[model samples]
Target: MTSRLVEHLGPSNISGASAVEIADRIRALILDGRLTVGERLPSERALAIELRRSRSTTTRVYDILNQDGYVSRVHGGGTRVALPHSGTTTVDGDDESMIDLSIASMDSTPGLYDATVRSLPRLAALRGTSGYSLQGLPELRDAVAQRFSARGVPTTPEQIIITSGALNALNLVLATVGRRGERALVEQPTFPHARESLHRHGYRMLPTPVDVDGWDERHVTDTLLHGRPHVAYLIPDFHNPTAATLPDSARARIATTARNVGTHVIVDETTAELDIDRGWAPRPFSAFSPEVITLGSMSKIAWGGLRLGWIRAERGLVGRLLATRPSFELGTALLEQCIAIELLQDMPALTAHVATRLRDGRAAVAAGLARLDGVEMPSTPGGLSTWLDLGEPISTALSLAARDRGLVLPPGPRFATGGVLERRVRIPITLSPERTTQAMERLSMAWSDVHAGDEPRTLALPHAAVI
Candidate 1:
């Protein structure tokens, strides 16, 4: 565990920092969702050895962290991660004063209430059975399959497995197919939790760069050919943060390369339908190759609280997933499955509602960026957030500065695998227009503070989970 924590620390320039400064760096890591909550920290001696710093300095670092409620040292458990609780503000609890931008999600869709009320009757019918649906309700799976078929991929209910969410679907796939020592190709500045999941599954990562301009096709094909990673986890449509969709040609090239290399391509389409104004979307990645595994969820299109998602794989792989799923979870909630069926039928309405909200948010964010110098928000017609180029590596500093003013913004580094991407940050379009305007105002003030050389190390930050 200590070795893993040391690995997570990466290449920190800790040689010249004071103990307080070192503590601040670790605190920033915690706030970024890299260190995470409840994880054990390295012992002072181990950390000192790894960092090549004095034992006294390491001891003081832990002391400062403990004093700040960032850690608690149990007599025999070593130091465990934690966050300070306060009456006025808290990381683990609710504090209405803070504008949390950590999660890129919106409120329930306008039609969610009606959908839930309609699903109640279906729920009553399920009481006669054991309520365990390992492959999800038949109706829901058919609905999901039909939607996939409509998108140009021929799918069947037999190839679908409903899970709690997209993340859960990914986990089930990993558990079934992950080879501990194999390599997995992933996107740099990809979904943080997805990266963490790959790490936990023990696949060494081969990161391919993805910027606001989108992916480099040559790099992807070359990596697939040379690295021959066991799997490639990609968000091809409306890529998260950057909102760069892969053109059909690029997808075809990647799919062909993966076939030649015998690499499994796991496509996350959670953000696929998040099209605000992108008039057209390419056919599903599966349409390019039958070997592709696609994960989809209603979290973005509808609401995350619904806790519903599905995986579309080949029939044989779907059988493997169903066989392995009981070791982790029995089945996805039956009620959510029923509700998803209704939601699927009303996707046109849901998409229109989401598109309107995203449009307003995009405009609000653009207006806010205009007030700040050097912060560039790219053309984001879709996806939940836009990746902002800060024009300098001040993302962590700026995040801390924003925290002091009641805006919780995860630094750019949080989105990447290692502690990099300081020149970028993700601002979600999930917020209402009014809240986004307010967040930008606070962000502008924070930018000014950073430029004025106001110290941000002393700022107290609430540690919220990044979705």
Candidate 2:
């Protein structure tokens, strides 16, 4: 599993060229698998010595590599290669294993489409066309409500209003609760798309911090009780990026606080179902505050292509959301609704399959990342991306380095909760076992470089944040 990266630009010949040229050489090495996963690269000092170049020139070279996504930087440590991904191919035709730590959610089952057609008769037989109902199709409402009830919170069809996806559900909640200029509180490093929706619709932001260590209970309690945000978006179940779930007690406390401040707490349970090891069955924060609007989706459980999500709310606000549906998404596809119902009926089988695959994938990535030195990851099993503490400040450079190798990964700021994590990255487990292993090995190389103080070695980025 351990290998040296010597694809091109032999160390002795790595001098008197531009930083871009040096970066290209390093990138080729990674792509060609000269740099294996988790291998600690030579220090900046050692590399400069090897290449017989000034330390500054060596620094610029690493900076270019960092920007291009071939390596990661750690403050006071050195740099290491980044985890590889699907399209990482070298000029020599050698390919680096790719780890997809970019997007959340795994691909869903294939039979889902056929399942929808089978359920159409009951809807079509309504003696006429099932015209648009602000409230979703009666059948889907029952199915969605039943899903919540089955999960523990008892509810009826009247409580469910199906929408386009979790994004739609959040929009409805924000529009009903927030007005422009009033602050809408959200967890820091939340789903970016949701954040964009909130911003585009004219709501100001008040970010509450949360991470893999768990919800920043005190900060969240303060934000809800004192900040007076019109609405507080809560992802108490398996948070994205950080993958931190609110413990049951904290969930209740935060809900109580939201009620005290009159902020409608909007709970997004998108990734709560994608846990690989422990059951991701965290109870909704709404259990403590039924006044809270809880958003659920089949996107992660099934496929993202299925654009169906639902909101469970108190009847009054639910009606407002229903009225606004035509302005945005008319409704969850009538046919998709039918298909979802069929999928729901056979949910146990799909659930078992998902749980099994996720378990294997999580183990594979977690084990691979653990092999790298100076990298800290939470040992507790949950969520899609592994929250990694890289022990240096060149996360941005690392991402750049990764890109040069044709392995695009999310930068540290992509997951910042009010701007604290920098020497970190989210190594997602969505890739196959072999790919994840390869990615981790590259990561080790990047970290080795970071520890050696050669990360972010480019002059163009001296004025820029290296993330």
Candidate 3:
């Protein structure tokens, strides 16, 4: 923020300079750390008032900072700091503090490996092991098809293709069905990697807005028809970042719109099974649009390292996708496939175990965030993170300030559709109870500090990354 001893640049002084010069000075102040991270800037109106410059001139400077990532606004929180250089990882290496709310994913079910080991004999029972088939292994395909078929969507082994993980499945489907430079429809504030993947392939993005009630049917439908999109990437169950599940009505509508408009929909159902509430599973959205491409990953339900996922599409499309899959890696480990096969067979017990842990973990984190002052906990029934609407967007600064206290969080833009969703931050359920509480406490302190105009202080994570 500008010092209280404001420089009231008179009309003559203001007339002597341009907006670009003011922006340059502010930029230098931020880059050199004189302004400090998470420090609020004088509002555009205030700056104009002090500098005797037009509001447009001051606004231009603020816009420059936003583009440079020096600052951003939260929904209700005033503009504060943007993501700091927290080195982006912890000493543990695997957990990125950016991936807050560790409670989002439950660890693998206990009997998963045991079940896989037990299945080896059955796999060894196969007479001959041959080279990779354009189609995945028949036995595994048949077993998976049966599972999906039971959910009211009949599938044949020929329609399924195995890939290293859901990412590969998504890439192949997009490669096959998506055209470069064409708009790909997606939800606002979507998974960051999904957006990156689309960008990597040279496809343009068309992000539609979503809220607690679900997707605006008109907005999505209009985009598909008029935008001339090639792919619709959707996360139908317990979506990442937002933790929202598209209702069945919205699901059916989206699927129908995609199919009718000749847009291939890639549905990512990685978190389909994590609903701790145990509500009735909405029929697989793919069931409503067989022409759509659907992707699934065992990583969320099993383990991230498993690297097992599958694509369900019509048989010919499956072959086309497989031909492109090798551009990435050869294949997922044969062992991981065997593991996923066993997990499916043993899901009854595995689901029970995962459910217990996630349910408790959610409780632990929710309880903690609720106690923080100035934090407005939004009502999200059953996804990993609580969208704590702190009634402000200064979250990015608070996040940076919390770094000195040891917690790292993703800024709101990471999930934005049209570069909106500023006031929000996602807190996944992946964190354990104890660590999450400590993290929240630090966040509260950061919030208090920044809102009160104090210099944002850092937190010490026992293992926080030092840049």
Candidate 4:
């Protein structure tokens, strides 16, 4: 745990800072979601050594944190992050109102309500029998397999396993393939919860850099050949945050390298179908090699509340997942599967609706952010968000200030495996055009406040469950 704490703390250059500065930096980490609740802080002596400060300074900082309800120390239990007095908003009062940009889900598709209505008869027919299916509903699994086949990846119903959502599918994959202390290759500034899940499962992450421009294929191939990680997780098509798609040439290199090194690749295609303006669509990563496992979800295309996601792997791996799934969950809900079956049948219509929504959203967010100086938002052909470079390393401070002004922005560090990417932040283009304009106005004001030295109002952040 001490070593993990040191790794998470990562290279803090607070060599000669005052106790207050140290406390503020630590507090910023906690608020930014990098240092989660109940995580133990390093021992005062060790932290003092790392920060090159006196033991008294470290002790004083701990005392200050304890006084402010940011941490609690037991005689032998060590110090842990704690909830603040004002409770979960992280700002004094005003807990009830704020625009949450942390969640990247889009609204339900136009036909979702109709689909739910249409699924009632099929659901009623299954009410007499047992609803528990460890693998998933046969019809839905077949439909999902057919969807994959349509996308140019040959698949069968036997190779598909349904799960609650993409995160659950990811967890199951990690649990099945990952061993304790093994290396897992991930894109730098990738999805935050995926990194959290890897950490929870005891995998040491080796990051490969990915940016708005696109993947550095050479770096990825080199890492795969040398790092020899047990698994490589990638969001190749319409990637999250950055919305950069990996070119086919890069995909072939990654696939060939992984196959040579015996690294299993897990491709997340949750954002693949959200194409708004990309002229060409690449085939599934698994199309290059049968060893690759692919994950897809209806959350992005249809609705997140439906809680439908599926994993496409070899039949043997699917059987293994089915056998081990009971320990975690009984099965996906029967109604969600039925609804998914209905939704999959008319994907053309649903996809068209999604494309229109995301196109307008992309234009609105890009245009709004363009009005602000020093904000660099790259235009993406697909995906739900933009990775914005703020031209400064004030992401955590900006997030804190935004909270005070009634907007919730996830800091850049929230997306990183380590304590880096402080100059970048992800802004979702999933809001209405009007709301996007309003949020940008508020964000501009918050930036100004932060730049002018206005501190975040001290409050307790909500407790996030450990992954």
Candidate 5:
């Protein structure tokens, strides 16, 4: 494990790099999720020997890291990783002053409050009963089923199982059908939380590359044929971070290959309906293969606070999911389910409101990227974020610099495994126009700082290629 962390640090001695530089690199690694919180660090003596640096240098590195709240040294626990406390302030003073660009979600839709109010009546009717719906409310299931049918995948209410959210639904699916110590194919530069979920379930990931353009059909098929992973977790529609959608032909080919390999395709459709002038929509991935288990949520289209999502699978698989769910959660809240039923009734208006916000937010990002030199912004047809190509692998440095300037943007490597994708950064299109532009301005300043060498020089993993 220390060797891998050392490898991420690259060749130790640059002409003038010092303990501060080393600490900065490690801090960026932690921020990128390359080194998880609570993971142990190598002893200073051991790290010094590995890096061919003096023990004093290693001590300073740890001291600097500890000062920044990135690590803690217990009596006999050695040094364990940690995140800075939320109350920690930046150079500018208060933490609240920072413009957080990490979350890719929006405020409640214009219809959410009214929908919640409408749902109260239904909630009152369920007050006398147990209120525990393991399979979810019948009305919400039917509404979700109809939405799937409209998306070009024929479905019945029996095929849907509701959960607390998309992540919860995903966890339930994995708990039911996932195999431990097996291979799971995932997209490089995919959602970080999904990667964490897959890891917690004991699946080793075989990552396929995805970029602003989209998937490489050849690479995906080759990986499936060669890796023969037990499962493939995909965000096919308006994929997170990159916001690239898989085309119909690619979807069909991937589905076929996965089916042939006996791989369960878990397609995350959380960002599916966040369309803003994409001018087209592909069929639900399940349409390409009946074996695909699709996850959907109201978090993006409606509000994250709503806490509602559902899974669409074969009735047998739905039963398995229901059986596995109670071990962790009794059921999704009844009131939230009722609100979802009402929200589903007004999806058209909800989606339209989201599209307008996304459109403006996209414009804000484009305008912001316009001011930065050597940064390329892709045409985001329809998604919640714009993936910027920085032309150089300086993303980690840029993020640190941004944080100093009161902006909290996740570096590109945060989206991938093993600290790769340094040439890319995902800027969300979910913030208000004003806040988005402000973030861009701060990002511009941070970009200048990175090029000026205010932050340490970091390297991507040698074998990890940015697509």
Candidate 6:
């Protein structure tokens, strides 16, 4: 963990900026959960040598951290990350010092509180049953199935299985389909948690690159043919982090290619309903091929705390998943299912509400980024985040600087398995216009601090790479 932290700190050439810079990097690690409460930090001498700074500078940085309540040092005990009450804390925990941009989820939708209150009467009727539904509540499944059908993909209740969320759905699929050491093809810069889930289930990852303009069909097809992966995971619409929506033609070609290679394409549509400026809604990927498995969630569209997501697959596949699900857990929650049913019943209104918020957020963030001289912000039509180019492979440094100003951002490399994309960072637009403006202000300040020693750098490219 210490070595990893050192790598994330990157190199600092400006000697005068070493102490504060090192302190900021350590604070960023703690806030990002890379460092936790009661975790002992490396010795001051060792860390100073690793950061290429003098021991006195490192000792002063530690002194500053101790003064700020970010770390505690006992007489004989080494320094450790402080507890929440002591000063440092997690994002959702008590501390309000830092603003979290690491998560790309939204707050509760407008009608959620009312929907929850209204669900009580309906939920009271289900108190008699055991509430252990291996598949899901019949009404909820029917509602989810109808949603897919309304989107032009024919679906039935028998083809839908509710899970905890998108990650749970992905885990179930991987558990059922993946084998140890087998290749799992995925988008180069896909969701970090999804990639972690695939890795945890023992599948070797095979990455195919994506860009702001969207996927390269020829490359995707060639990789699928050559890699012969067991599972291919893709986020077709308003992809996470990159915010690129795959074109229908490319989707069709990729689906056909995967089918030819006997690979199951798992299409994640968690961000599909967040369309702010995309003119038309494309048909679900399953519409192109029956082999395609689609995953949807209320987390992004409605609320992250809802913890409800569903998988749409063939009836036979659904049965297989249901049979295998109990081995992991009994079933999804009943109350959450009831809430999802209410949300699904009024999805049109809910989607409209979120669309308005996202539109304003996108505008505000875009305007804010424009104020910065070197940052490059992409034009994202619909998604929770916009991928930004920082002109050089200093994403880690910039993130550390942002942390010093009380803003937390996940660096670009977190989204990819390789270190090739260290020049980018994903900024969430799910925040309100006010918060978005503030975050951008802090980000600009951090950028200035990082480039204070050198001239501001800029890169002009045809399209931003996905990962």
Which candidate number has the best TM-score?
4
Residue 120's lDDT within candidate 3 is 83
The Cα error of candidate 6 at residue 360, in Å, is: 0.9
lDDT of model 5 at position 356:
96
- After the best TM-score superposition of candidate 5, give how far the Cα of residue 408 lies from its true spot, in angstroms: 0.7
lDDT of each: 0.87, 0.67, 0.66, 0.82, 0.84, 0.79
lDDT of 4 at 371: 64
User: Ten consecutive residues with minimal summed lDDT in candidate 5?
Assistant: 458-467
Q: Show model 5 residue runs off by greater than 4 Å.
A: 1-19, 31-37, 45-60, 67-69, 74-76, 82-88, 91-96, 456-467
lDDT of 1 by residue, 1-467 (tens): 33665655554644577888678767888776677689988899988988888999999999999997889999888998887775444322243377888889999998999999999999999998777689999899999999998988888999999999999999999999999989999998798889889999999989899998999889999999999999999998889878999999899999999999999999999999999988787989999999999999999999989898999999999999999999989998888888899999988999999999999989998988898888888889799899999999788889887887778899887777556787899999999999999889888888998999986643455554677
lDDT of 5 by residue, 1-467 (tens): 44656755655323246898778878877765667788888888888887888999999999998987889988787898887765543345343476777788898898988998999989999999777688899889999999999888999999998888999988998899988999999999898888878988989889999998899889999999999999999998888888899999999999999999999999999999999998888888999999999999989988879888899999888878877887998998898899989988887788889999999999888988887989999889887788989998888788878877777667786787766787899888999999898888878888888778676322221111111
Model 3 weakest 10-residue run by lDDT:
458-467
Distance from true location, Cα of 404 in model 1, Å: 1.6
* Candidate order by decreasing TM-score: 4, 1, 5, 6, 3, 2
Please list the residue runs of candidate 6 whose C-alpha ends up more than 4 Å from where it truly belongs after superposition.
Answer: 1-96, 454-467
Query: Could you tally the backbone clashes for each prediction?
Result: 0, 55, 26, 0, 0, 0
Model 4 worst lDDT run, 10 consecutive residues: 458-467
Local accuracy of candidate 2 as per-residue lDDT tens digits, 122-230: 6586436554446677877898788787777888898998877788788877766768877888887766567666766777778877767877788888876777888
lDDT, model 6: 0.79
Query: In lDDT terms, how accurate is model 5?
Result: 0.84
C-alpha RMSD (angstroms) for model 3:
9.5
Best lDDT goes to which candidate? 1
Model 5 TM-score, all chains together: 0.91
Better of 5 and 6 by lDDT: 5
**Tens digits of per-residue lDDT for model 4, 1-467:** 33554455454644566787567667766765667779888899988777667899999999988987889999999999876866354443344466678877788988988899999999999898677567889899999898789889888999999999888999999878778898899998788788888888888889998899999899999999999999899999878778999988889889999999999999999999988889998988998999899988999999979898989999888877887788888888889999999899998899898888877777877877776689888877878788999998888778777777777787776777546787898888777777777678778878888888887664536423211
